[model samples]
Target: MKPARKLFLGARLRRLRRDLKLKQVDMAGKLGISASYLNHLERNQRPVTATVLLRLAETFDINVRQFAAEGGELAGPDQLSEIFSDALFADLDIGRQDILDLSDHSPGIAEAIGRLYTTLTETARRQSPSDTSDPRSLITPETWVRDHIQAHRNHFPALEEAAETVGGALANRLTMIDTLCHRLRDAFGVNVEIASSTDLGGATQAYDRSRRTLFLNALLRPENRAFGLAYQLSLLEFDAILTRMVQEAAPSDEGVARLLHMSLANYAAGAILMPYGRFLESAERHGYALDPLCGEYNVNVEQVAHRLTTMGRTGAEGVPFFMLRVDPAGNVSKRYAGESFPFSHYGGTCPRWLLHLAFQTPGKTITQLIETPDGERYFTFCRTIERPIRPTLTDDHLLAIGVGCHVRHASRLAYAEGLDLAKGMATPVGPACAICPRLDCAYRATPPAGHQLAIDETRKTISPYPFLAD
Candidate 1:
């Protein structure tokens, strides 16, 4: 055919060779071809035939179509072009081809650029107060929730199946925590005792490295005890599996990756305790109700919700859920999810949602449907939980925290059946005024930092709230 057509295969082959970190001589030897002949093929001096392509595929354990397509690849250039177009690079003096070349030749540079961009963005957000007010601001609270969910790919079929299987046995045992304690004693011969008043100075769960004994604090709530037991069990049963999963997840942040590793280990422990199939059946039988599920498992609302997101493990998968833990001032401490939820880079922005209102009605579950300016709707449930700061001391105080989740998949919940979701509907809320374009909001605290404000002495519009457009 034409010279251009011939060159396509050559370029793809070159790209693949580089991606595999293979040298020309090594690849030529594997293909039983001369280095000179391979070089000619890569330069489009010779066309790659079907038989050669098949042989290459067999040798590399790749598909024949993939081998053939690699000979004349166009995908890499397109992807490189897209990466260079990112807003982070908008002000930088760079060309699309330069980015492609860098990505092809030096992936490290591209990754460095990404990290730098993230750091700079974070700095900008912290410096500007108005940035915090914009519901659409990149640093809003929803970002953390979204990232946690994205990290897990919103799937946990194994955990769900395990919960269903052990849920019934756990239901009758007074508490999942108690059942786990018993399991520890039976399986490992480790007697788990909550520490009494005299033992208050020691660690909550201390493993006598010398005696091989395990001691747990007696004062811990049932859920916390169960979680501790499961966490310990994970270290014994699935350390290698957890390591493998962490490696596969390839988290960008070391802290987050470490947390994910520990979380997965705990998840494995929970799976071993509950098993997947039984939990799924119980969840379905119970109509996916939170209170019943929590009672059945001797867990709390937050724990139940956290476990619900893990139910994607087996045949009975539920809608992916995202969970967040935030304080009164809108600071998020923890977030986990099984689906992609959009928010700013930092946290969630939508302020009008029940999550914000839940702060006003402390110690109660607030349910509401929130709609964003973009018309995306989410059903949300929120409530506050308290934990004492110091359990051993008589004067120890309690800290109140709010936990929330979206109802995108709440149809299976027993509590969701009779609720009227449409009446007196309030529009979804966003984080702050800076990022949110809703100019008419009565809650606008200050003008967006980067936006210019308009002044009108003649007349005033109710909603235009005079912010100068940048």
Candidate 2:
């Protein structure tokens, strides 16, 4: 029998050593190996022995399987190669050896190059009118926030409990605002002032800590002012808690981390404005109706819908729902999932989905029974909400907010009224045109990623690119 082939794991060994913040000599001493042998192993001149691998695992407190894995062992090199394959590098006659040599010897430079290309690609993709199916497209701070939200299943019981702890007539919307206003004045000796949008520079809320004043954009609809107040409260009252949450993320990008912190603070604001128990009870009583909930809570429809998804308190759970808000250009600004829906992390949603049509009937709730490529059925509803930057600004900020739940729970939704869901009368939709596999879809923007392009000169197919088998 042939002996097991020795593993040439140069990159992994180097990465492990660097991650431990140890020099070659220090790492070699810890592993009970000579520094010269370690250097040879790190340069792929010598194979990693089983004994050294065991020592590595024990010393680094890492799994042996990590070293056994081969795919990401040279991921920097592979990613650098992919970066070169972009149109920007099309004119250059770059070779495999050049890429490998640079990545292996100067991994820092290789990583920097890869990051530059990804940032440029992401910036271009973001400028496009449509949300992209590119996984890298969600590289924005919003995606990171979505990740943390999804990890918690769109619920933060701690935020809810914290809101409970900061109670001041929170059961009543008007009373809660009054109480928060009092707290703002009494606790911080700060006066809450509403100013014109121009004065506030289109910001929903801004705080002047030195002046001991909080400025809210007066252009915001009256229903939204409470949220602005709550947002400011989160920043002022629970800043340490908020900072702790952000620190837990330990994001490398300060800008992205700051944005994520703001997003989470907004969540805390919403959670406080609508304390969980009272809001949850009202939601169920109102059949999860956005308008009634909005009226009941004195908040906007977007706030009510957003708050509904955060109702995932264990044992006291609401109907599992997903919410998506897309701008007119098809950029998804907000996304939350209570169940596994076909939401693409990298790209725009299916054009055939009801939200695009909801734009036509602006300010009106539209409902439809939709099916994903995976045959999952949901009862979804959407309506457009205007978010004008200021009183003088144009109405380009219209965003369509959609919320849906499984067909099994559709009966509980007011939007699913009078729908014959049993007969399988669901309109098929998917994550995005680029990644969707349904061939008959007329609105597909691009060919599916996994399928090959079979452009027939002699014949024409219904779809633009005739999809061939993988």
Candidate 3:
């Protein structure tokens, strides 16, 4: 038999101690170990024993699996690998092991590098107007909120509990839209009214906080009407929870804090609409099929898709899925994840990914098996969805929702039917044309940034942009 792997979690231990603001002696005493022993453990001079690991978990109320993992932070390893893969660092010739070691030992540094990369990429996109970047100022409020949500794996227990309470109170109600409206009026004294689109000044929904009234555009569908009512109810009913979450996030500015608050409120609304216990049961019973869940919960497919990304409750967790919604112009409007999707931080996504093709066949579900450049395969499904109508605004709104999980979880999904999953062919895709490392993609729209182009004056290759192999 092979030897058991030794657990040397020095960096994680040290980081934990620092985070808890405990000195080595204090931590050692709490762990029932000598300070010298703790020091040795922190230096990786000795492997952590099972007893010590258990003690650490008990003392800190943290999962020991985090200590065992190479990187304590969930997003660290992948972000580090992605950052180091840039051609700017190509000359360094860093390998996967080195990246893992850095992520393991110096996670704070790794996080700092990730932040720098985000800023750099955001800045670059700003210089090239044609490139896709947040239209807001350089603060990147959306990026901050996205990172915050990903850090928590898109689940918030407090919000879930509040939503469950609301849902239970309204469980016996037959008409959800009417139920939501009645609850809003009875609980918060806020009257819900459908108003002409011209009166709302082109907004889909507007709330008069002082007057305690909500105005929803007449053009909104029944699903959107219910959503608007639920969103308003969440804001009024769970303001404290939402505020606490935003404060805990410690966003860079007030704008980002407000955005985070709005996002949490949206999560609360979804949870309230589809309570955790009932939704998870229906999802599993239907093999996680999108349409059945939509019909069961009286929600739209986009709502169901977004809800799937938030099914990361501790004990009753569902499949860890990542979701993205993009318009025909390739603008990603909504992205949430219980799993990392390796989304591009700078420019547009890979054109070859089936998500782009979803616009062609509206209202039809299409599934594909795709492999990233790193050889990680996933099973994904995409379908077109229309945004909620705003009669006063321009009417060209259409979007595609793409949801996927790792290939290991494919067998559990209804969309993965009839495929030889073990040996099935997967279309190879990468992050974005600007950063993708795929050297021979025929559909590459732009050359890989920061790499020397492999120019051939004599002959032409299938790929439009060829770069030197490092």
Candidate 4:
């Protein structure tokens, strides 16, 4: 028989303990081990036994396979390799073992370095003529809000509970909109009115607190108007809850705080409209068909896509999905994830991904299997969605929304039906062009940041900018 391989899961165990918010002693007691022994296991001084691994899986409700996997989404060796491959770090002698040690032992510092590098590259790409030395200057309110939302895996339990309560009260009504309008008037003495696009001056919805009237743009679709009402109702019903959550997010800038407040309210609105438990049941029963769910819930495509990312309610969790919304110009306006998608933290996403191609076929749903450079595969579906109409907006303002999950979960999707997932060829994609190491891609927009171009007068290559392999 072949010898059994040893399992050194120090880093993963430590990260799990931190995620559970447990002290070393507390975890040790639960594991029926001494704190010193647990410390040794966490520091890689001892290999984890099979019995101990199973105990951990049962104790914490974690996946044994995922916990035993090397590296992680945030501090993976691939991410560190990409960051160090930049020309700015060319002077430093960073070996593979050195990167491995940093990623395994001090993952937090590795992730922090990755974030700083991303901020630096983003600042440079924009050619911001201001201070380029301090990368922190490039951190915008949106970045802060995005990071905060991602930290929670896009789930807010406090808002979810409040939404469920509100949803119960609105049940058995004639129509959601009528009930919402009546609630606004009876509960809060706030009248709802549909105003012309010209009257709103290009805003989708406006609240006049002094007049106690909510003016919604008439051009909005029925679903959006309902959503606007739910959003306003959430603000009124859960002011203290939203305020507390915003304070917990602790964004330094007031702009970031306000953005977070609005985001929380949006979460509440989705929960109130969809009502978590019923939505999850419907999603599973229907194989997560977006259109069917949208029709059943009276919501739009974008709202359904966003709600899918927030199904992390523990014990009733749905397949982890990451969603991205981008305009025709390649600008990503919204992103939420329950699973890591390796999004471009610095520059534009890879052109080969289906999200960009979704713009080519308007109103049509498209699906593709993509493999990141790290060899992780995902099943993706994308479609064009119409945004709420504004007076300044024209027909050209269409956006593409893409939702995806790991290939392991592909079988659960209706869109993945009749597809050979095990043998399907996946399109290879990079997180971004500058950090990509693939020299054979003909569509590469930029050379790898730190690699040397193999310029030769005698030979032409298929790739426009071929570089020497590391």
Please give, for residues 345-377, the per-residue lDDT of candidate 4 as tens digits: 556678888888887899899999998886789
Off by over 4 Å in 3: 1-101, 121-138, 172-174, 390-394, 449-453, 468-470
Best candidate (score: TM-score): 4
Cα error, residue 407 of model 4, in Å, equals 1.3
lDDT score, candidate 4, position 360: 82
C-alpha positional error of residue 237 in candidate 3 after TM-score superposition, expressed in Å: 1.1
Q: What's the true lDDT of residue 362 in model 3?
A: 88
Full-model lDDT for every candidate: 0.56, 0.73, 0.81, 0.82
lDDT of 1 at 387: 50
TM-score of each: 0.62, 0.70, 0.84, 0.87
Question: By the lDDT metric, which is better: model 3 or model 4?
Answer: 4
Evaluate residue 37 in candidate 3 and report its C-alpha lDDT on the 0 to 100 scale.
99
- Tell me model 1's lDDT, rounded to 2 decimals: 0.56
Tens digits of per-residue lDDT for model 1, 1-470:
43422223565567668857899999989898889988878766677776668767777755443234311222233233333444444556455447555544444454455444444555576766344333233333333323444433445444434334544344454655666666667777766665663575645566665665667777666676776787776665556666766775555445456777766666665665545565567677887656777676656666666665665543345555556776667766655554434444333445555565665676677766666554556666677665512454574232223323345455655656676554536565654454554556665654533344676879786645676532
Q: Candidate 2, residues 1-470: lDDT per residue as tens digits?
A: 65655666776788778757899999999999999999998887887788888888788765464354432332344355556645456567566568767765655566567556655756765765243454443356665566656645677666778876664344456566676778789787878888887787768778998898988877777767777777887888788887888887675466668887888888888887778887888888888989998887778888888888888775577887889999888888888876556566556788778888888898899888898765768888899987834455454767899899889888887776677876758898876565566777777777655455788899877778767653
- lDDT, candidate 3, 87-167, per-residue tens: 788788676568667665555667677777877777675765442344334537888898778766688888998899898
Clashes of each: 48, 4, 0, 0
